[model samples]
Target: MLSSNIFSGPIATDAPPASIGSRKDHPVPRLGIAAAAPIQTNKFYANFFLGNQTAPTYLHPYSVFWAGAKDTSGSWGMAISHIDANQRVYGSETNPVTGTPRYYINPVGISSICISAKELGSTTAVTSDALTAFSARIILRASLQGASVIEFPLVQGSAFVTAVFNGACPLIQTGIFYKTVTRSTKEARPGITKYKLYLEDGTTWLLYAHHTKGDPLDLQIINNGLAQAKGPFYGVIQVAKDPGNADSMYDRTCGVYATDVELSGSAHGEKGTYTFNFKKAGMNLTTTLAMFALPHHQTSFDDQTRDKMTDVKLQTTTKGIAIAVVADSWTMVEPSLPVSIGFVPWLPEAGSISNISSTNKTFIHNIAQQEMKQDILAQTDQPSMYFAGKALAKFAVLIMAIHDILGDNNLAQAGLERLKQAFARFAENKQQYPLVYESAWGGVVSTASYANGNASSDFGNTYYNDHHFHYGYFIYCAAVIGHLDPSWIAANKAYVNMFVRDIANPSPQDKFFPVSRSFDWYHGHSWAHGLIETGDGKDQESSSEDSMHAYAIKMWGNVSGDKKMEARGNLMLAIQARSFPMYYLYTKTNNVQPPNFIGNKVAGILFENKIDHLTYFGPQPEEIEGIHMLPLLPHTPYIRARDFVEEEWNTYFANGRAENIVGGWRGIVYANRATFDPKGAYAFFSTPGFDPSWLDGGASLTWYLCYSAGM
Candidate 1:
């Protein structure tokens, strides 16, 4: 059970803009979901219900896509693909002779095995009717009025794909062009049928059919390579990758399947414990259940729980290999959750920093006054929500530093008034591109795409891309304003809570939004890609910004006096610290990625099937590494490890290499350097004739100087 205080207050009350309505130009079709409530726009299983519904949905060890649709190879079932390390293809090397390679990518939608029913063919219809946080139900039925209907439950972490047949016969097909299909009867179990499928490449797969309420199935291979069972059957069919001990492994988790996962957590002082309780549908309670645990999960498992782990380790596309663990529940504890730091530079030694030299204080106050004179409207009224929100957050930080660190009440009060006016532009729905409650998919989205008739407008906000990155900055700004003046919270709490619910709603009790929309608890991170179908699954480019989003939630909870919300944010930040080092931030000791690809230091664009060292905007080295370090905040030092930062500096920006960089990237590089060398970073920012162009649109000299000095 979740803590009673996890979510209760303004977030529980759903409020949309008064004049908002559904956009007419969006292309998403409401498939089996009839709630008329808000549907999840960015989740792991979204590819199964979007577009032609043939794109791959990766659930770790196994990935499945609809194959009968026109978008795929035109087969009549669900195609499954699993890739090992040997199956990966490498990109071009940086140096022809001695340099390391740029990337390594796994193959997608190979269809090593296809699970189909005899009644499914060209005239069959496939629809994703039911969806949840961890599983989705894909329905397959023939076009005939009286045809049998089959349902396949695709669950995360389950090694097998289970299909429940209703008056239909099983037909096991393959796009891999199988070389042999052999029926095995070595260990006979009641109500169970077994077969081994061998592909041309010497790969073997195990198929087990469990009899539920009908006669046993007699499957045989005919002239074609596919195996087929006789007609008019009712039972469950399961398919799995045969590592070894096929009989023993199948018997342990024979007739059971995971339907969904229930998540709950609680934080006490500096520690937090979170759990994943699987909801299973079949089999007895004493039966052993098998689920795959990632590297991060395995590292945190207790000694007693780890003793039950098997030696079967399977390769995942992006987040290293997953180990098979036999358990129904998994519990992990984050020992060092960030529970103290507030709206100031964070010091692990003393929580928050206050001491500063008189000279530096005078300089910072002077810079703040100069920057505060500029027009706030011109900075925050842009068409793009990402940039405009960032601008608002930038000024909010400057105002806080002036009031908290420098003790200038009048100057801070003046700037706070202008900041509130700028914030009202979006809260009142009066920006150039106002937001609307997209009734079709059921969350707040920008009207820029619908107005211009382009899906890519505003960085695909209308289609559900980077919602957290766009709205997190505003949440932080609201927290600062509400902290300075508690009276302001009553006027704007609903509007601010709407943005929080759009991205990080913690409970499903609020019917207008899904729970924890952006963060994936299983993956220990949040994904940015949404709605669009791609050869690779979801990808997140900015790990630093991801941490910033979590930091904003923590601060907002503190200001709003929501203890559980604050605790949840602290747990999320701690999880990011543990998971980022294993996958995204590569150290020399890492054994997860390929040996030759570790020299790059950073996983630039991490996709499900590939890890490419580049960004969607450009191929510059500074841009690739700088995306993970922008808008430096109080949580920056806690998330970005010191040793990793030292290695990154030596590898890319050492020996005055950072001095040669131009534009806002120079400031970003200097701010990141402060994690290791505070004095050097302070010198760079406090230079007599500092160029304002060197600062990013979302960064200020006052915040950077104070951060460096405090460190």
Candidate 2:
């Protein structure tokens, strides 16, 4: 059995026997007002009684009380309780020495239960003597509203038992509760008053009372009084016994009045009024109150700026009132709820490579072998001469692939040495690295603070903006290093895991990072900027880098035996394969696309809510061409539309753009295009006097050769 202490607050000391029944004439503990001074502290009170019909009148040993709030002055108190426990009941007076005296407030308009003492807390078998005694009591207090003395019949034989009042407690309910007052002129019934109150949780409660209908305290005047009052309005609702019924409570006709009307509108200008115009013009008391009390009728809203108003819907029998209540802006709503994600990795199951002739493959191989020799001999011992992690990751990717395809242990060892040096630098001077991993933010800091009091160029960068693009290269390099040297992986897995957690893990439970901040579950792809708020919102400029991120995750997950990561990678690829074509990559005869049609050129950056078909840096030809080339590097078995590749080649590369393509981009574009037109791609690379300087450090001649061979 679970220990009672496992459940905090009030818990039954023992289990009650099954045969327990209600007893009468129990000696009631006298309770008197200990101190009714205006509540001066803004501290939280555990229990405040709000009368709900279904609420229990008597205290239960195991009952958990609803949380209560007191303003700074403590003049007023509001609490919701499902059950009464004699511990510190707010808004009521209690004398500890005599137990209790005076009257008890019960929920006026609802039903309550009378339970036996044994039922309160009995874990063992109940003795006959234990069953004979009653456990609780109830007493009536005189009406504070000038009503006649109220009394209950005294039982002669049994011990006294406490009676509980019942009514709705907005705090105990699951949905939002808020009060709104509007200023527009609306009809006011003489004795009826309407109130729309909100709970801190953002659940709204609509109340209508007929008691003060004809008085100066009617709903309209009350609104005006609150609008003009001294401090923000705070209230306490009281429920008393019905004079007409001895055995039951009154219906909806009971009085519901504000306890402290003095604090209604004070400092009105400082605290703005929350106003609302009901859907209809008048109020329907029964339906409105009933709906507020009904559990099924409750709803919640997300606090998003784009569609804040549409998050909730309020329907009323009569048009709701147009009134406003004074409150601080911070008290209006809650922060946005955590995002929900559904990530399923999809491993590429099928697709065939277009065949390349042996003559072309041999020609491509000769070019790749020569480039590999030069790259291997170019490594330097000096650390400062080495490229940054992002650039180094690219070189590692190419060299590792070259070594694997050609069975060259010399090249593999050379690549391993470079990786080792890179790892050593990161380990020794992690703080100096541009892409420093930040445990506090659960992502890498793109820029670092230098010892010379200068911040790196990318310091204080936003989340996930270029994370995938930057981290993908590193993660891909790590995966390749792990594959080439298992010992290196065993030594560096922890360091490598940081990148994995940043890019793929979707659970906020991770202590080091936020849940998949970059990936958008709604869009079925990742966004680059996570927390950074651009005026236009987050966007992803490099669709290729997006795919590269997934590819790296998939490969690393496979090597690391994390099926979930592999699956996420596949799922990302699958989604991008479909979403990118629809949004980023344009083909002829495209009908369904983002608004503001640009030509068939790929959209360089896609934002969350908007689409800009332009690149971030500008409309450079390489920027447009490279977006389609990056995903082909890893060449995981995922499908890329051949038609799209053909279209890109015809639209951009086929028209002499390849001749002007500089550095690594030339090889990337030509190699990727080789997938479709091997003869043309091979002929271009094989031409005499071709400059090896044209090859990007990230580009792999081995990959070019492999593609030419249809591998």
Candidate 3:
């Protein structure tokens, strides 16, 4: 069961400010300036408290923003702001005169901008806390305050209320740094800028230029409590040499910053010495890591009892300049079908909290408890999710949500622990992959399987990339869950700067990827999902399936923290409305002839969607003689809540639909593990917000409530 460590919403805790500064509107800022802001750092341990062998990382957070400037060059600019940071410059395009959003300031010359975030621990030395990874969030805002050379924005963690600099300088440093663009898109203008600053913590930082082309070299280290990340601190700094130029170092890529530097070990007993290297390597930024092993002895998983011990392999680039880690392998995820959590043996005790809470449960406590337990048990034999075995991948989201939703430390920690296990299982046998594989767990799981059991993309591309979109979904889900579980991803803390930057200026309203047809856009329409028929021996055909736009939008929102999901979700609803033709049908199943759908006309829709709906050909076979969830749209609405709730929330937090899924947020499918059923009488709604709110919506709700009540 999830440990009950729901983070619930935002907290009221706050930290003191370190220092504040100001900026002016002179339209230009300088280099070597410094700023300080209140940084809160929090650390917690799960492995020790859980009494489990695996040691996990706790989430740490604090906030910082940059303060820089822009020149009248209409090109020279420096992007800076430490807190409430934004990824795009002048990304906020609001016509103030019209009260309509226009654009953010553009192209600030940034020679060097500083960014930082800290988590303030409530008390010294947390109890029974083990950190698996460490991560942070910084919100940078544009402002002009004062002098004292302070160049970043700081937030009073006490209320999440942002604070501008104390004095006014010509520049705003903390948030986003926009570089000058050599060219602009058909609809947007370009930018150019530069700003640099140093830190009192003895770290040197890099700044962006008006015309940005390269990225800074950095490494993020992940460690469990079993070891502390230690490093000998080996590095080489290279730069462009100029005999006549005395400020040569000022214009070129010279290495300057390193944090948590250790000669041989890290906090929490980690000794994997990750080497830091920064310089011009060929035409791109390059980073190299050299880790030293932990002294822990080997043993089978403390609980899993499997003979295969953990194998964490690290691979180097072809040129041997960069190192890539092939995380531990997941035991067997996809056997012949998706892995159902209800039947995953170890889990079901924890149904999704959101689902259970959303359902109109019985008024009585014991009955409600029993109903919840049975809800999970009832669906034991069902497939893990709709398609693409992404269930396990999305499940990682619950961990992040735990610490935020319920504030149940035990349950939240449990979720995080399980998430680590799932990730390890997902990142398996890297050496076994083909030369060009990129998705994290490509080789470990079968990329594809035919009725004859073959790995051929052509025979069935559905299964081929089934265990896909790991990093993509992980980051996205983390963003949403993080809003609640603020400390999500403390362990295996990756850089979220990419996501943080996109919040203010997300994909513009008009930008879009042209899909071949309704289905072929992302993975073809079938990728959304397929309609399942019960009591039928026939396997599901991908063509009957379609990609759930809601699912995609949900993931994108969670990852980006931008509000673009609503529009995307609404767009999918429109497409689906036409796809299913929503008109009611009173059909005599036995005589419902399946359409060969020759020539254009209705067949055009099928061809456009790339669905082989014609596979059944001719009259629809009268097999079940019962009503099942079929598509008039994208996804099949859940007729059962068992899919949403599991024991604690392994299923719920990872879920996508509210009526058909948990929070109507996460996707309806899982990845890397579909090698994996249900009951009761009653009705349930399919699409609540979009579908007919009166009849179809009401009936679907009625059925779902009955199922939840265990009627």
Candidate 4:
């Protein structure tokens, strides 16, 4: 939330005029209060507003055709008037070619006036209540009007209908009405642009103003000029054209308002002082009051506790730069996993039979070394039990292999120690980590550990989704630890087996846990959602994670000497290779293997009933194509189609390698390509400006090296 306080009075009688413009057209004779005439041609006039509730109202009824001119001086002005609904003597503001007025102008109801050098063109209008309806206009005019500034009150007998101003300045400002007992400003902080405007009159009325790089137009308005209010009344105004389509002024525009206008803690000139706070309510001539008075509505949060935790502090520095310190306290938790057994053979020993070029091997080794250094230096005291666990496990595997190749006992010991600590945390249930062993289900379950603390803080949130994806890293880590220290596997095998059972249990006899809940026996690949209902149906976001689950099971089976588990893993891989290309990855417009979901392009997320060729995070080509190749690194041999890999590479990766490849994704793309085009993969990884930060901690040097050697 973001807010700014403003405390000023209504426009003074002697205030300066907005701007001056040279006369462009001949001045017409003033019309009397009562006059009428027939309609005229070659003229355009619109009825902006006409109603009679508390008072008669009419705004911008006159037509100024050439008002959009960009010349030095032109006709630039706005007039607002109110007439009784039954007033028939005054005709429309249309004149004949002879320059004779056809209707009378109601001088008695005229409320506010503004003038400028710029012409106003392309006027749009919207009218709606807060919750059900909203009406506004995006007026596009020459930028020159920004210099003009003037404001005045529209009084009808004893009452002031509204205060109108020459809001046609560099930044457009309007008026709003709000009443509250208390008001304050929220501070600013890195990566977060937030301000708070809270109204404390029984029901809380908050108006949050935010400006950030993601929204450029709003940023421009904030930089140029925000809103300024008078007295205690809140004023609503619109500023800046919509950034989405600048060419079309009729689109969205930035809205700014002040509630319970007041200045506290500091004076205008002094370093730290106090100012006045106003409390009055009879003026109704502002746009702000009209907009917010309607009913307000918002979507309910799934978890109320998941709201942001923010801190705000306002202070003026010695240099008089008023700074507000603010911060958000919500953070994500990382996942954990133990080393597994099947990864041992992939670990390169000293002087092992190697087919990879020294150059490619050196590039892979450098990436591994850099990633290990980052992990070693990182504070693992607080880990996000699921995602981060995969990264940590990859680090352990890479370091163990690096130790074998370089004979660095210290590096291997450090990796082992980290794994031990991570394993102990899960086993002993330290820090109330959410990993639970459900004896009834005969498996281990991860609650909403990744969710921090929210309403969906349970396994049910993810439902049957990603169990294999989440548990695969843990299974792989346990196998690695078993390879290094056989006794450790014996002590932890029971705990490790629980995760394996959760993902790969063949039968449904357990009752508590579903039989292969995520993996679809019919589709041959796992779905990412089992609990949440998307109207379109259940879908899997990451196919790579789906394959990794099966690979982890196979690896775990190898180390634990469970032939049935190992065979199941192999079967799952074979099924995925055949079904994935036909359904998930498409080379042709029509393929029937997956049935009813075939398409010309790969489905970013494949659902039971539909295929959306869009990634959940964004629409980047890498997000769509890169995900399919990620699982290929550890499960390279399982991908039987070299042609499919070639097609994917040629489609998205070949031309824009440097432009498209981004953080974490670079490793996945290049490592997967290593199996087919080892030289190209090495070249990309060794590119001069290649960033080490681009390497995903989940990518293993040993896996890359192993795949490169075979290629």
Candidate 5:
């Protein structure tokens, strides 16, 4: 096949290889490791060549050269399966003698490079599978030049035989993987331009693909001034398994293409190549085929967004984790969990005491805590990983609320356990991590390599990290899931501790990785803004229980029965009241209104910046911390239901939002389903609402506020 020389040297020669950087006869693939020239526009992103978890935006480990930039330049993923998983054609690999000990050869999935193609005149992409394959069929997407027509040559390496061109193709595509369904030409045009397809199976068979006619040329194939064909055009096609092999040339024996179809606009160009590392698809615990399909976009939202709550929650959880067998699409997610969507529906108040029962008047209110937990407010700009966390969080939140809403504690408890199982997939040692770009689910991602590289956005528990928000929010879930069969909480104490510690001192490091200076896409904004590493944020000096840390201390207090935890919560609450921007105005200009509070989101302040008038908006006057926190803050939905009696909550039904006390913010985008300039305080009506396809562009956050002091 290949001139037996490609396998030039002994692969595993360096037994107990000298440590890296050693100078004595060092040889470990002598690989080139140059830093790819950085694109100056966005400095924060370094995924183009860096092998960190945050830069998972590019499919460098799995995609092929022909796939184009799913996120970056020169990042094609390739893999080597343990076995012939999805059998493809034409390739080669060396096999050791029968009794010799075999090396771990195919563990990476792909065996070798592939080289095969036909002339420009060919129609079908089919290549003949003449020789035994040592590799698989490589996929190529033709999206360059914005032209509908494309011509790819069937090649072995530098050389080309024929071309595979789609002349006068009407339908232009955005991504590769376009399906060919049309049986014949929609029209006909000039000089060998009108092409059709046929096939044969062999190496280097004669190809037959036609070019569209330049003008209305005389052709018998035209019917009433139009051209159409009922059957597949005739042609010779060829195939191969690996490109290195000498016999890898394509032929028509396999019906790849018939003879005599001319190619007009065919040209050969070079696209960089890459080597992939793969494994048995099942080895990674990707349970369903649905995981491999293209990704379904999460519903986008803006600051304080108020819609698509359910869909966002569902996509977050269901996407790469669960395999839905029974029903397809959101319309079918059954036994709908109790959801408290935006705005309690207006059913005219049927006068107070004269009614039979308070429950009758406050039907939605009876399940207020339960409904609130289920009322997810997912935004469109969130990372899919964020959605993954949402999925788990949604399930946990709903289950915890079940007992309160339906008075079925057992069902709620059962739901938590199921949720735990789902969340476990994203956890690294029982602690959540960001989701994979192409989660082993239906939604495929192409933005893994943007300046906004944020693979860890959804699962991290650092204060600013969205997953941190989820971690604190999910504490109630942990209790329920472990109530019945308790083992996880105690077993993963380290994880719990790390989570708590990170929450207390969520600093620039926790918010980002490497350093803040590496990229600008990342900046501290208190939400999934991007992977901003500022070397700032709130860094802690000690892990010991202290008043400075409220969230962490509260968590540990609940779990460890530590008194200092409560004190810390108290102190943290006090600090937050002054700095949180919920009630204070920034004075950025004379404006920045509705909610006058100027928070990191409203003020565009990085954590590293000092809180002086010159840096931050300055602390507000007369701010009360924990004094007003309790009446408004609902306890974990589960605990509230179980601990608080009916009498305790009945008063809440009469007046929920009388205080006008504003606190937590989801984001402005969350309030309205449109984009807003982050620099501005309010959303602009001048621009059209974001087209759903551009969810990432106009993503917004929704803010939440406690409504009353009476509770």
Candidate 6:
């Protein structure tokens, strides 16, 4: 009875997703100053402005934070820290000196340089403004003086921490205490002043001050390792760590400060390219821009951009060393994206669904029919949006398989009607824990956490945690519904689009939501941590789910006929395919992670400060590896390589070891193994008397069988 045209006309590209009835203001308490414009809840620099505001925000090679200047003689400034690879302290479980290690950590380093203003004191107030995906501008003002002194631009991947003095003399100080201060008088360029600062630990840094008003650079080194510049300075002051041969490379990019980053990406057919253009600010433009590229970025950089890479390298806490590149813009290309992947099992090369055997098709159909007869309302009516959404998505996949793969239109229709009703409970905001569009942080969130005053309720939904992972399943469900019954899209377009905008709003032009709220363009992946402040910084646990979220976006875009969104989704998937292996999914040959650490196969719970070989729930080998393998969708094989899967299987789940594992984890490991051994997976799922409990709430037997058999 649910028969309808699947491919519908494209919706209006500019039409924003409706906020729906959940636009009511939430009563939950939120910390930090509220922004008049939409606030970015999930971003790299959010730790700086949110919570205590003193926690360091990691920007790869360099990190900066507000110190409050309580200890340093009332000198209010942002503390800058850059730790070397040799400075990493190994975990107690493993030792790098004598034997292989289990973990490594790089604690927050001592500030080498603190850029302040001569006018700033203990009473200076600090606030962040102009926050974007890749940048945050820190403003320091003296409340009594009623004048702003300086603004520090903190970018995610920029090498230099820039200070723009606004009518205040620049005061450069070091917490570690400077051993020597050598002022560079080499007439490198007009209106440019350079200073070489030496620390007690033999660490050297270069400070380049560009004067727009032609003021003479008379920065005097005062007592206690403090340096002060002369009056009414209105120009840029940038500082960078001396990478050994600093005089030549530092001079090329000292004057030009990368204040922000502009991200643009495009996907054409199977090829995808995403570009990061460093928004340069300062007096100099003739010279090239000097910015640090992460290891993943460097590996994917085009030949033209890759050639500009310098030998200078800086160690990051978790992502290995970042290489310094002399270029204004860097574009990474992925020539083979799984653009053809869809709701069904698809082969990228053939650009179509894989041929499934007749026996396997009947086997999948019997399982799907049996699973579809279960009580949908009982499973999907849970209070938690995460679990409820997962159930809804599970059933949606089953219905799709019945129709598309099984060619059983009548059964698919019956199951789809039940699914639509279950989804209606969510779309109408009638679920037990409905969503509310909280304007304070700007996104739709579950009322469960807001009402209960529990931060961990529904996995911190009210606090903007895991928005991508929570809402992505619902989006995928809606996409499948739209694909099956095109008539459904008209009524639910606004509701489903709201979820998309919440997680992956593509443009700032949309005022309702933050642009790319979860995805970090500079890092080539999305971070799950939000609002909650941690010493380690933002982290993402499930690389597979991260890629699945992107695949959902691609499918939703495809069904909705939003070419740009579809293309962006394809591009994001490509980036994740490249980035996940380097940072999260560790193959035996992966040199990106530490040699001792890579033995863990998968980078369990990758944090900015440390990589623990475990998950939040449990430390079991299955749990550690299974978190990234669940809810395996169509394009999973594209991101998760066969080599890594095989290596991981041999490491943990080889020789029937997976069979012994209890609960849903066993299914996850086997589902992941399907990427390499489809025959084995097909046999496992197709076997009679299979335990239904093995499947996760988000997974279905129909999908597992179709995926394996088609492959």
RMSD of each: 2.5, 23.5, 26.6, 28.2, 27.0, 4.2
TM-score of each: 0.95, 0.49, 0.26, 0.47, 0.28, 0.93
Better of 1 and 2 by lDDT: 1
- What lDDT is obtained when candidate 2 is compared to the true structure? 0.37
Instruction: Return the top candidate by TM-score.
Output: 1
Ten contiguous residues minimizing lDDT sum, candidate 6: 1-10
lDDT string, candidate 2, 1-711, tens digits: 111111112111121122112121111111221222111010011001112111111111111121111211111111222212122122233222122221122221111111111111112111101000011112122222221111111111101111222211111111122235432133123343344333343333333333212222122313311212122112211222111221111123223211110100011211211111111111232321100100010111112212222112211111111111111110111111100111111112223333345665456546655654544323321222113444555556556545654445775586678666755555344324334443323344443232232322332232234666666776777777777776777666655666665555444335444345455432445666543223223457777777877777767766665544555565556556655666566666443342223244565566432344446554555655575566455342243455676776776667686788767678777766655675576666666877767666555555555554553
Q: lDDT (CA) for every model shown? A: 0.79, 0.37, 0.21, 0.39, 0.23, 0.79
Q: 259 in model 5: Cα distance from truth in Å?
A: 82
Candidate 5 ranges beyond 4 A from true positions: 1-385, 404-406, 427-467, 470-476, 479-488, 505-556, 560-562, 581-710
- By descending lDDT, how would the candidates be arranged? 1, 6, 4, 2, 5, 3
Query: What are the per-residue Cα lDDT tens digits for candidate 4 across 1-711?
Result: 001111121111121111111121111111110111110000001111111111221111211111122212222323222222233233332222212222222323221211221123333121111110011121223332332132212210101122222333322221111122122332222221222211111112122222221221121222111222221212222221111222111111113222221222211211111121221232221212211100000011112212321121111100011111111111111111111213432321222223455655566666655655654324333334455457646765676565654344675667777767766665454523455433222234444433354323333322334567767767777766776666787667656666665565554333323345556543346766533324233467677777777777767666676655555565566556555665566554433322222222466666432355556667666666676666543455344255566666666667766346668777777776665576676565566876756667566655556455545
Against the true structure, candidate 3 reaches a TM-score of 0.26
What's the count of clashing pairs in each model shown?
A: 0, 81, 190, 56, 133, 0
Which residue segments of model 3 deviate by more than 4 Å? 1-413, 427-453, 457-486, 489-549, 582-711
- Ranked by lDDT, the better of candidates 3 and 4 is 4
lDDT of 4 at 515: 44
